[model samples]
Target chain A: MLGRLNHIAIAVPDLAAASATYRNTLGTRPTAPQVLPEHGVTVVFIDVGNTKIELLEPLGADSPIAAFLAKNPSGGMHHVCYEVANIIAARDHLKSEGARILGDGEPKIGAHGKPVLFLHPKDFNGTLIELEQE
Target chain B: MLGRLNHIAIAVPDLAAASATYRNTLGTRPTAPQVLPEHGVTVVFIDVGNTKIELLEPLGADSPIAAFLAKNPSGGMHHVCYEVANIIAARDHLKSEGARILGDGEPKIGAHGKPVLFLHPKDFNGTLIELEQE
Candidate 1:
């Protein structure tokens, strides 16, 4: 089942400006941008006590967030990640309930090096959900 | 300064269906729907241990989320709320940094009955941000 709310991912058109907004405007220290070639994103993490705010910018032409940025040029909340105890069991449960799993229904190593799977946005009230094994 | 991530608000087109999805598919217990007429939203809270996932549905024609739902018909992440130690100080700091505050620039009672203010999404990478007095 879902446990902690892992992190909220925001797809930003400009990673530096977004990081500066959180650092200066929100008065929070955001981590330096780290590029994840596999994920096709340049990410910066802003620790907000209990959870993290991830600022993501497209890293390449085929970046996952590239389409999102094209639609919302200014950027927007991309997905919400939740910690799950047993991802395989969770995926099965979700499947039994008629919820669609994104990708090939397999958990992929995520940004945190943990097993994660994305659920179809349509099945989740148009909100993209990422379930990460805790 | 910002403290904990209070909650992530998701505006759903169907409140009951959204609540059921979280309760059944996600295997989390969600609170009964609470309608906030002033805020023009009917909300359901799903506790995710460290923080909460707020499911919001437009309450009336004047609902603030109505326009958002119109654009994203099925529903989507609406805003992210962070706890602030001193809202007045936070507001001043954000303003000084050239971040535009939403509304009349005054903190209003939020769904949790705490003073809250919304920041312009354009200034925050297209992500609407809500700051609540802790």
Candidate 2:
């Protein structure tokens, strides 16, 4: 089962601008920004109580975030991640329910260094969801 | 400016079945379902951690949710609400930054007996957002 909200991902054209916007709006700056080469994006986390606001910016035009930004240039809420106890079990259960898994087999290490797997947007309406287990 | 997560909105066709799906998945049932006349929909809330997952079902074809479910019938994640301290001020500031306001002037009372306002999906890309302050 899912626990607390791990993070809410936001896709932005510019991470610095988005981080500054949240800082000015929320009264705090984001944590250090980190780049994920595999994901082809850079992310910055702004702490919000127990939850976090993750700002993602594509590193290049070939990035998936770039494609998303093209459709929604104004930036928007991308995905919602829920904390799970056993990701493999959760993934299996979701797959059985006809949810499509984005990745291959096992979960991969995410930007947070936790084991994470993504559910295809096709299965989850138009939203891309992530499940993480620390 | 933000308090805690108020509710996570999820779009679904069959409210009863979606509620059942979550109940079977989360090991608990949703709170009593309620219909909002103004919103033209019925909603059910499933408690999770300090937040709640809100399952939304359109009451008729004219409902905005109906359009959303039409595009993605498999059900998907919707908008995320952040509890705010002052709805009026928050709305004003977001508007100044070129964010489009959806509803008319003044915040209205929502189903939970709290004051709420909505931001147009244009500002946040494809996401329709609601801001609640109680």
Candidate 3:
């Protein structure tokens, strides 16, 4: 099951520009950019204390964000991450209920260095959902 | 600045089926459906303790979700609602930052019975953002 809303991730064509919007306009300073080579994304977290806004940019040509940007020249909300107490248990439960998990059905080390699994967008009403073990 | 993420909304084709997924599959109970004729949406909230998952279904043929579903048959994540301390201040700040607020450039009473405004998808990288005054 899902816990609290961890963060909502936006796929941006330009991370710096997006970060500047938060910093200069929204008055929220974003965290330093962290590149996740495995995911092919460079992410920056805008902390709002209770939750965070994650800005994601394509790290490489093969990155998923790059493909997403190709379809949507601008950027868009990519996924919403929810915290779960136990990811394996959550994954198993979702699988049992016929919800599809992405990426070989295995949990991968995520941006927070915690185990994370992505649920298929189709199963979640076209919203790519990510479950991070807290 | 944004406070806690109040809820993330998902547009679904079938409110009952989607509610069943959360209630039976995900093990989360959803609240009763609330119809907002003004917004043309029928919504149900799934409490996650810290936040909620708002499931939206089209109230009529002209509902925005109807158009969204026409493009995306299975439904998808529509928009995310963030909580702000002051709606007017937040709207002004976002406007000054070059964000386009949807509607008549004013806050409208939202589903929560609070002043709410929607930021254009273009300004927020194609993500429809809703700011609700807490």
TM-score winner: 1
Best by DockQ: 1
Candidate 3 structure, TM-score to reference: 0.94
The lDDT per prediction is: 0.93, 0.76, 0.86
Of 2 and 3, the candidate ahead on TM-score is 3
**Worst lDDT 10-window in candidate 2 chain B:** B20-29
Ten-residue stretch with the least lDDT total in model 3 chain B: B60-69
Model 2: clashing residue pairs? none
**Superposed model 1: Cα runs more than 4 Å off:** none
The worst-scoring run of ten residues by lDDT in candidate 3 chain A lies at A20-29
Better of 1 and 2 by DockQ: 1
Better of 1 and 2 by lDDT: 1
Tens-digit per-residue lDDT, A42-105, candidate 3? 9999877778889999997789778778887788888888899999999999999999999799
Error of 1 at A99 (Å): 0.8
- Looking at model 1, residue A83 earns an lDDT score of 93
- Candidate 2 residue runs with Cα over 4 Å from true position: A25-28, A96-98, B25-28, B70-75, B96-98
